[model samples]
Target: MALNDESLQELKAELLDELVKEVPSKTLLSLRLAETRSADIGEILEEMIEDDEELPAALSLLDILSAERAANVLGYLPGESQLEVVGKLDDSQVLKLLEEMGSDERADLFNLLSEDRREALLRRMAHREREDLKRLASYEEGTAGAIMTSDYVSIASGMTVSQAMMRVRQTAPDAETVYQLYILDSDGQLIGTMSLRQLMVARPGAIVDDIMIKDVISTRVDDAQEDVARIVAKYDLLALPVIDVDDRMVGIVTHDDAMDVAESEATEDFHKGMSIGQLEDGVSRVRLWSLYRKRVTWLVLLVFANLFSGAGIAYFEETIAAQVALVFFYRY
Candidate 1:
C-alpha cells in the first residue's frame, strides 16, 4: 500500500526503533519498506542521515533494496545525502548503482564526486560508458545538454514501417519515452519525427520517410534549461530532442526532467524577488552562516536607509511640534 504522510511518519519511527537496536532485523525492515514508494523511502533515509549516529541504519536500509530500486531511490535524495551514501560504498558497488541509473542521473552523480574519486571511477568504466559520462558531464550546468539523457529511440530516414517498428521494439525498453520517435539521416542529423501510434497503424511495407512529419521540434544542446522546459511545456511534448550546431541528435530532455528544471528556475526567481542571493541547496540544508551572509547585505542596506527617515523626522521636529497630526499622515 502507498504510504500517506501519517503512515510515513509512523514508518520512520518504527524503522528508527528497529535500527537503534543492537541486532537490527533486516527481514522486518525489508517487510516494512516492501510496499513503500522509493521517493518516500528516500525522504526517510534523508531524515535518518541527518543524525550522524543514524547513518549506518540508513545505509542498511539502502542495502535492503535491489540495485535498480536503490538507484531510483538515490535519484530522489538531496545531493548531500547522495554523497554520504556513496561515500560509504566501494567503487564496484557505486558503479553497479550508476549502471542501473538513468543516463542523465548517472552523469549528475558522477559530477558530484571528488576529483580523485572521479578519476578512480572513470578508470573502471568501459570505454563507451566512460566517454558517454564525460560527454554528458561536460555540458554547462544550466544547459539543456546537462539535463538531457541519450536514451531516446531514433530511426533511420529510409526505413520501412515494419523496420521502424522493429527498431522501436529493440530500443523502447531503454528509451526515456517511446511516445515520440526521431528520424535521423545517414549523417545522424535529425530530419523528422513520428509517434509510436503513427508507425504502428501505418501499412507494414510503407516507407517511414513518406509517413513521418518533416518538421521536428528540437532544442540546441547549449540552450538554457529554462527555455527547454518552456518548449516542452508549451508543446506538451513527452520529450524534447536536444541537438548540436550541426543538428545531430545528442539527447532528449524528458517531461519530468523539464518540470524539475522549471521548478528550480521558479525557486531561483522567487529567491531573487525576495532580495536573497542564490542558494546551492534548499533553505533547510544550507549552513547558518551562509544563510546569514545571503540575507545580511540587503537587510543592512535597509537598516541604513531607515536612518534617513529618522533624520527627516528630526528635521521636521519643530513643524511636528506645531502640527502633531502631520506625523500621522507622513508618506515617507
Candidate 2:
C-alpha cells in the first residue's frame, strides 16, 4: 500500500527528532521500522536534510543502511556528504552503489577513488558493466566518449512505428532516457533520428525511415567533451549522438553527462594550474605527513627555480652597484 502524506510526514518528523537528539542508532532503527520504501528514501532524506542541520547523524544512519538504500540517501545528501559517504564505502559496496548511479556520476566517482580501489571494484562488477566502464574509461578524461552513456534507445530503419514502440517498451526500464530514438542501418550506421513525440503521433504502419530526420547533429567518439558541450549548447540539444570511425552509432552524450564532464574537467584544470595536488576526498583526509610528502616534490622544484633566479640577480650585483643611478631611472 502507498504511504499516505500524513503518515510519511509524521515518520519524517519522528526521524528528524531522533536525529537532532544525536541518537543515530535509535534513529536508524526507527527509520527501518517506519518501512519507508527504498524508492521513497532519497526524497525523504532530501526533505529532512533541507530542514535539519544534523547531517552527521543522518550520515551515520546511512552507514547502517543497505548499499542501495545508502546510495539513494547519499544522492540526496549535500555534496560534501555525498563524497564523504562514498569514501567510507568498501570496494564491493562502492561497486554495488555505482550500479545504481548514472554513467556520468559513476565515472566522476570512479575518478575520485584510489587506483587500487577502482581496479578492485571493476573486477568485482558484472562483465557487461565492466566492459561499459572500460570503454568509457578508455576515453581521455575530458572527451565526450569519457562521459557518454552506452544505454540508449535505437531502432532499425525497417521497423514500423508500432514495432519500434514495442522495442522501446521492452527496453525503457534499462534506457537512461527515451525522449529520442536513433535509427540505424543494417550495418549499425546511424542514418537518422526521431523523437518520442513523432513516434506517438505517427501511424502504426509508418516506417521509422519515413519518420526519422535525415539531417542529424552528432559527435565523433574521440571528440573533446568541451567541443561536444559547445555543440549541444549551440543547438540546444537534449542529447548528442556519438559515432565511430565507420559512422556507426556507438552511444550518445546526454545533456546531464556533458555538464558533468565540463565540471570535472574544469575542477581538474583549476587544481593543476594552482599547483595543488588533486585531492580525492580520501586523499584530502590522509595524515598530515602523507599530505606533506605528496606536496614536497613540487615545493622542492619550485624552490630550486626561485634559487636560480636569486643567483642570477646576485651574479649581476657589481654591474648593478656601478649603475645605481640607472636603477633609479629604470624604476621610474
Tell me, by TM-score, which candidate is best.
1
C-alpha lDDT of residue 201 in model 1: 96
Off by over 4 Å in 2: 1-17, 20-58, 61-83, 259-332
How do all models score by TM-score? 0.90, 0.63
In order, candidate lDDTs are 0.91, 0.74
Looking at candidate 1, what is the lDDT of residue 200?
Answer: 92
- Give lDDT tens digits, candidate 1, residues 1-332: 66787988898889889877888898888887777889899889998888898899898889888899999999999788899999999999999999889999999999999999999999999999999999999999999999999999999989999999999999988888999999999999999999999999999999999999998899999999999999999999999999999989999999999999999888899879877777867677789898788889999999998898889899999999999999988753
Best-matching candidate per lDDT: 1
For candidate 2, lDDT tens digit of each residue in 85-177?
566566766777788766655666676667888888888988988887767767776677776878899998899999999999987876778
| Model 1 residue 178 CA deviation in Å | 1.4
